[model samples]
Structure formats: structure tokens, C-alpha cells
Target: KYVPIENAKYTLTERFVDEEGNEISPSVVKGTDYEEGSEYDVTGDAKVIDGYYLKETSNTTGKFGKGDMTATFTYAKLGKIIPVDPEGNPIPDAPTPQYPNNPTDPGKTTPDQPVPEIPGYRPEVPSVTPTDPGKDTPVKYVPIENAKYTLTERFVDEEGNEISPSVVKGTDYEEGSEYDVTGDAKVIDGYYLKETSNTTGKFGKGDMTATFTYAKLGKIIPVDPEGNPIPDAPTPQYPNDPTDPGKTTPDQPVPEIPGYRPEVPSVTPTDPGKDTPVKYVPIENAKYTLTE
Candidate 1:
């Protein structure tokens, strides 16, 4: 018969699926039909006829999720109903022994989630205390593009020049939009970088910052004692020869790091002379002396 959400009654099946694609035959669920709707929701263990009513629903029927553990009850009417609880009980231990319905999906347990042991493992989680502000945490960031590796490639370019992708520490570290790494760069340990002063960074991080500037690193292109071209070193763009087009190094004329200075006020006699405070200073270059 058709039933409403409240004051509802429905039947369920007894046979179910076991994990590993096996079939499971469950004992039938036996219960009297309770009306569906809001009155059914008396949460927690309440004494029903035989088992505990574990839910707040009026209807005697329940639904199940896939791969979840469920309890099957053989209704006294020779029918079945699924309950949220895994332990199937025909009669409530206590009247209205209630918990919510369908705690988990049936037959959907994965290989990893074995049937939980009676004494389950429960770890204690520490509570966060707002009053404890005395702790400190360290931070470090490493980028993937900065790492270097040896690769086999063709020795000649389309113009019969060489195509090399050699990188150096500090020297070729690309300055991307996200990080501000303006440093007096120095090459160190293979392909990594650190600031000349307080600079901080990871080795082999960031992109090939100066793929265009590789020719500037003179020592990379090796030669025999007689200065013959190394078999793979392409005829450098600078060609290490003063006569070559690269009369300058890639990082050359590196424009000085920009500086910032607060704007001078009009200094009118009627204005708040020497009393106004600057809201902000964009560039903090403390090296240069101010005349005002």
C-alpha cells in the first residue's frame, strides 16, 4: 500500500551482498509498522518491544547506502526492514531504543576497512587552546623549477649552433611573479641559490630564470688546452669572443634595485608643519641619507 512520509510503513529484503562480490543471506527483520513522519524521531536507545528504537522516525522502514553496514529485521508480518544500526534486532531491548537510520551504506565496505574489532582504536586528539600563544613555527619554501638535471640532447641548433640548458645557483634563478628574490646572486653548490646577505631559498627551485643569459657564464663551455670548441658546447651567442654579438653578459647593466623616498610636503606656514605622519612608505631603502 502507498504510504506517506509521516505514518509510513515499508518492507525490506533479507538477502544482501557480501564484500569480494559474494552474496550474504541475513536473518529476516521482524517489526510492527510504526507511522512515518516527525514523531518517529526519538533519538538514542529507547525500549521498544524487543530491540532499542535507534531513531526519531515514526515509520518502521529505513533506507541504506551502498557498501555500508546495515541490520536486517524479519518483520512479524513475514517481511523485512533495514535499520540504520548494524546489529539486527527483531524486538526492541528497551521500548523505543532509538538511533538515527542508515548510519552507513551496506555492502560498500572497502578492502582496507576490515570489520572493526570489538575494542576499536580511538586516539586522543589534543584540544586547541586559544590562551597558549607562546609557540613558534618555522617556515621554508622550495620551488620545483629550480632543480637541475643532466639530459641528453642534440648538440647543434637549427643554425648549426649548440642548444645547451646548463644552469647555475643564484645566477640563473628566475624571478617569478609570486616570489621577490632580488639578490646579489652568487652561484653555489650545483644549481641552487641563497641571498648574498639574508636571502633565503631552496636549491633547484624556481624556473630557468635566465635561459637567455646562459652564454654569460664563461666557465661552462669547456675547451681543450688549445681552446678548441668542446664537442657539445654550442658556438656561444657571445662565443666567449669579444668579436661575438654578446659584447655583454646576460645579467649585465643590472639596473640598481629600485629605492623609495617619502614625498616632501609643501611646508606652508599655515599647514600642520612637522606634525603630519606619513601613512605609508612603499620602498624601504634605508641606505640613502635624506636631506629633509
Candidate 2:
């Protein structure tokens, strides 16, 4: 008394397209009632979607007699370029750029990127064009306008040679700009200062010296004709090695004035403002020979 056995109606669609199909999410049908030939299957769920990147997928395993079946999942869009530093602040390693998803026109404009040299920085724009293929595209950078240096006040002489002539002081000074050069130091006759290089520095990027380093000034006084200083006279015999020109004060021996006759039999040591005099005079001719 039994006679029928019918049941066949399976459908399954999942589509999330956008390579050109343009639908980007929302489409998930399913209907079931299969038994015609008895064999069926369906599975699809690529979904993560933000900047998109799943490329392609269409035949998601099926056999419900082939009546309605879709699966589709194709997406592509993601192009970043960020490199800021004018206040936007993001130039740490600074070399980023990746783009390759413009199926027809994600807004269209991508093929230029090559602006990464940053050694003192200065790049408002030299390359980078990606107009929104999925966001993130900065590129700002700016900090290189310093090129006028020239602050050289050097007068060196501890051995670096060049004892004078090198002034220039300020020709314009840039790059952080704040030089002092210690008031441009220069009285240098017998030399003194002994140590300094870049004196007070702040300006950079080329041309800037500052070095003062002198050293060569000793004493050896015994002056009296009128120049004064002859009270004790021996305390001033220095120059052990101030750059040894035979060490200076070894011949300073004129200190005996009982009847007075010293016009300069021994004091000769120049340089420290030139002072070489050991004068005494008052012995006018007196010869009395008497042999016992």
C-alpha cells in the first residue's frame, strides 16, 4: 500500500565579493531537503574584511543536484605609506610603503613612492602618491635648513701650530645656532689660555673650529733703571719647559750691588712682554794697584 519518495531542494549562497563584483559582505542563504541522489555539502566563511584581502574563491564543495550555489568571496584593497615627522610624529625607522590592490579604481593614484633619505631631514614631498586604496598615507618630514656655518676663531699653539690669524667669528652661524667662542678670545702676545676646543658650541653641520689652546709665557725679572722690580729679583726665573727654546731663564745672575756696576752682565729672557734689564751703574773709574 506505499508508493512515493520525493525530496530534493538544496540551495546555498555565500558571496562577499569586491574584486569587481562589489558587494563586500552580507549574503548567506541556505535551504535544505535533500535526498535526490543523496549527496550534499557546503562550506564558506572567509570573513575578516577590514582593509580586505582574500582574492578569490568560488566552488565551495557542492552536489545538491546543481540548482542554486554560489560561495564567491573575492576581495582586495590595502595600501599603506606612513612616514611623518613635522609634529605628526611617526618617523622612527621610516621606510614604509606597500600597495597592490586597485582592481579598477579604489580611488586610483598609486605608483610613485621613493622618499627616504633622512640624514638631517627635509621632505615635505619628493615621492608618494597612493590616494586612499584603503587608508594610511602620511609622509611629512621637515628639519633641514641649516647651512651657513663659519664660526672659526682658532688661535692654537700647544702644538697644533697656527698661533694667530683665523678669525671669521660669525659669518652667519646656523644649525642649532648658539656659539660663544668664549668672547672670541684674543690678546695672544706671549700666549696663555692653554686649553679649549669648540669653546661653547651649538652650531653644527660643517665650518666651525673655536680652538684657543695657547701656552708660552714665563718670567725672569730684574729690572731697575726705571722699569722697577728688583727688590728680591730671583723669584722670577721660570720656563723649565714651556715649549723649551733652551728653557729660557738659566742666565739670570746679576744681583750684587755693593759699589754698583751691573749694566747687564746676566739677565736675558725675553717674550713675556719683553723685559730684559739688569742695570746698576755708579762705579766711575778707580784703579789703585798695591802689591804686598
Encode model 2's per-residue lDDT on 53-90: one tens digit a residue.
56667765655553556667777776677767779888
The CA lDDT of each predicted structure is: 0.25, 0.63
Instruction: Tell me how many residue pairs clash in candidate 2.
Output: 0
Worst 10 residues of 2 by lDDT: 238-247
My TM-score estimates for the predictions, one after another, are 0.13, 0.25
lDDT of 2: 0.63
Q: Flag regions of model 1 displaced more than 4 Å.
A: 1-6, 12-17, 37-292
